[model samples]
Target: MDIKNLSLNPNYNILVTGGAGFIGSNLCEAILKNGNSVRCLDNYATGKPENIAPLLENPSFEFIEGDIRNAEDCLKACKGMDYVLHQAALGSVPRSINDPFTSNEVNVSGFLNMLIAARDAGVKRFVYAASSSTYGDSKNMPKVEDIIGKPLSPYAITKYVNELYADVFAKTYGMETIGLRYFNVFGRKQDPNGAYAAVIPKFVMHLMKHESPTINGDGSFSRDFTYIDNVIEMNVRSITGKNPDAVNTVYNVAYGERTSLNELVELLKEYLGEYDSKISNVEIVYGPERKGDVPHSLASIDKAKSLLGYSPSYDIKRGLKQAVDWYWKNLQ
Candidate 1:
């Protein structure tokens, strides 16, 4: 389905927490592109102002530099907002493993702050970024939303807690909440310099620099890498769709396909090499499996299709090509 076909209330004012991060910034851009007013709240802890630098020029987009953990900030951001897209959180399994407390503070306590603030502000809907990591330790392929395994890391626990809270809020306060369990999302503007940088951008950066990319495991572990445009579509559908059954439900945002790490490296090398032939020779180095990481992840998009009419626009190979092109143009 085309995103422009989705009927949204033009007068609605939206609040996007963590609106300066990769996914959040993209959501902000999409919201503004649809002719809606937006209020963005970000602490800039991991989110950079440069990500939203272009949006600042638009009078419809207003940004408040604030932390989600602060109740006052969340309340202020949520005021007069019709929809709340809470994307602010500390991600990465290794980072959570190193300091679970900080992850809990940002992901758990901060999430609660946003929920309460949004509910109190009388917002129409609350949508937050839930992780595919919430399906931890489950050996199931194409994981469905109803079934999930025990959380393996602090990050997983934090995201799973979001679903739990969303459910309770729906039942108790009559507030509607939707959780989008995003699988390995990658695209332009995804940070490549950080220690906690995601695999796609990190590999793209290495391949561009003619450096060997490291595979975390024996290169067999796989993931259902999702593109940012598909994610943005899901957000738009969740907020604008008229289905009552779709509200307060969690859907897996993915391409319903999996690619191994080794295959992924080859794809990146092939794409980036188009810009520089030498990058084709960039070798891959295998390392030990990361701690607190799941062996595999693949999402079932059937639920999203049946409920939210989520038709992903791009698959892995197509998405990687677009992402590589963007990084090559912008990062170079």
Candidate 2:
């Protein structure tokens, strides 16, 4: 990240909730590289310790091992921070379907806790992770931020409530907040070993092992599989943006293109095959469509482009190659 190009101050203090997780840890690394002070708050519930282990060596990075569910932890994490990047949330649709209580407790209540803490700490801006699932059951291709449909799952409800709370907080308390609705963000450091692991990383790991990965529906289900660098750029831009119009609203952080599961698998095989030719012959299995899963997800990134000047450098093919390389070197 070019601090000068982004117009970011090198001395700003930033707090990243869930800093031990995939997205948050990546944010910490980028911010620290830009010469900013970073404090991370995470309980390691879903966050992995290995993701953040290397960051501990950095003098500018601080990790607070605490849960967002605890108000005191949230308060401590928010104090003395210029901006808050709240990325802490329980993040699986299937997991939420099986365990709504835990999902609500963390995604919704914990999110509220972070908001109150940031408000009290007088943080300049609070940028949080919203979800594409918030556009539930809406058949609109290239989903615009303003035209959201009803939520399809409990996890979706929590993320949607975040936008609502952010708006209300801005109006009532005069807080500067921005919500980024990420669409299927995947890249290095994303876990592929969980029951609710995201498709990209999970499939990558399986393909590396020469195992068949199951696609939920007929290979037609598609997603706007965003890269992690793009997501990191959005978080940084949200904090530093000078536009008042961009401060209070939500923007879709995506590549603005959709890739079907079949295309995604083929791309993964093609990329990984460069390392191991045998991977090219791996078969993909089909199964029942996932409950609460959308048929297609494609975002219109015009709002992010116009508002924050977000220009995503890596599309799926470009980003997937990097991701595959990382997994091959690290996980294999």
Candidate 3:
């Protein structure tokens, strides 16, 4: 991240909620590298400890072991911060389908708690993680933020509710808020061990072990697979952007292209094969389509580009190679 190019000040203080997770930890790492003061708040329920372990020794980094469900913890984390990056949420559509109560508690209620805390702390801007699932059941190929359809799952509902709350806070309280609706973000440190782990990492892990990965549908389901660096850039741009119109609105953060499940698996095998030639022969299995999943997800990133100056540096192939290399070196 070039601080000069982004027009960011090196001395500013930033707070990252869920800073021990894949996306949050990366944000903390980048901010610290940019010479900014960073405070992280996470309970480690879904977040990994090793993700933030190396950052613990940084002089400019602080971590608070706390959950967003606790209002006091949220207040404590938001104090003395110039900006708040809210990435704390119970993710996964299947998990939410099995248990809606826990999802609502952490995603909706906890999100509200963070908002109130940041408002009280007088944070200059609040940038949060939204989701493309909000466009659930919409027939649109390239998703635009304003043309959202009814949510398909409990988790999607919660994320949509977040956008509502953010708009309310911005309009009613005069707060500066920007919501980024990320589309299938993937990269290093993304956990592949869990049952609800995302497809990319899970498939990578399976391929590395020479095991077949199951595709929920007929391998036609596609996603706008975004890279982590692109996501980090969007967050940083959201916090530093000065456009008045840009605030109080949401933008889709994506690479503007879609990759089908078949294509994705082939790409994974092709890349991982470079490291272990046997990986190229791994077979992909097909299964029933999962509930509450969309057939295709592609985003129109023109809004983010025009408003936040977000130019994604890595495409799917480039980013996947980077991710495959990391998994090979670390997980293998």
Candidate 2 lDDT over 155-231, as tens digits, reads 99999999999999999999999999999999999999979999999999899999999999899989999999999
Model 1 TM: 0.98
Clashing pairs in 1: none
**Clash totals, every prediction:** 0, 0, 0
Tell me which residue pairs clash in candidate 2: none
**lDDT of each candidate versus the true structure:** 0.92, 0.93, 0.94
Question: Which segments of model 3 are wrong by more than 4 Å?
Answer: 1-4
Give me the candidate number with maximum lDDT. 3
TM-score, candidate 3, is: 0.99
Ranked by TM-score from best down, the candidates are 3, 2, 1
Candidate 1 regions exceeding 4 Å error are none
- 1-332: candidate 3 lDDT, tens digit per residue: 45456767889999999999999999999999899999999999999999999999999999999999999999999999999999999999999999999999999999999999999999999999999999999998799888989899999999999999999999899999999999999999999988899999999999999999999989999999999999999998998898888898999999999999999999999999999999999999999999999999999999999988999998999999999999989997
Q: Candidate 2: what lDDT?
A: 0.93
Residues 190-211, model 1: lDDT tens digits: 9998889999999888888888
Residue pairs in candidate 3 whose N, alpha carbon or C atoms collide under 3 angstroms: none
TM-score of every candidate relative to the true structure:
0.98, 0.99, 0.99
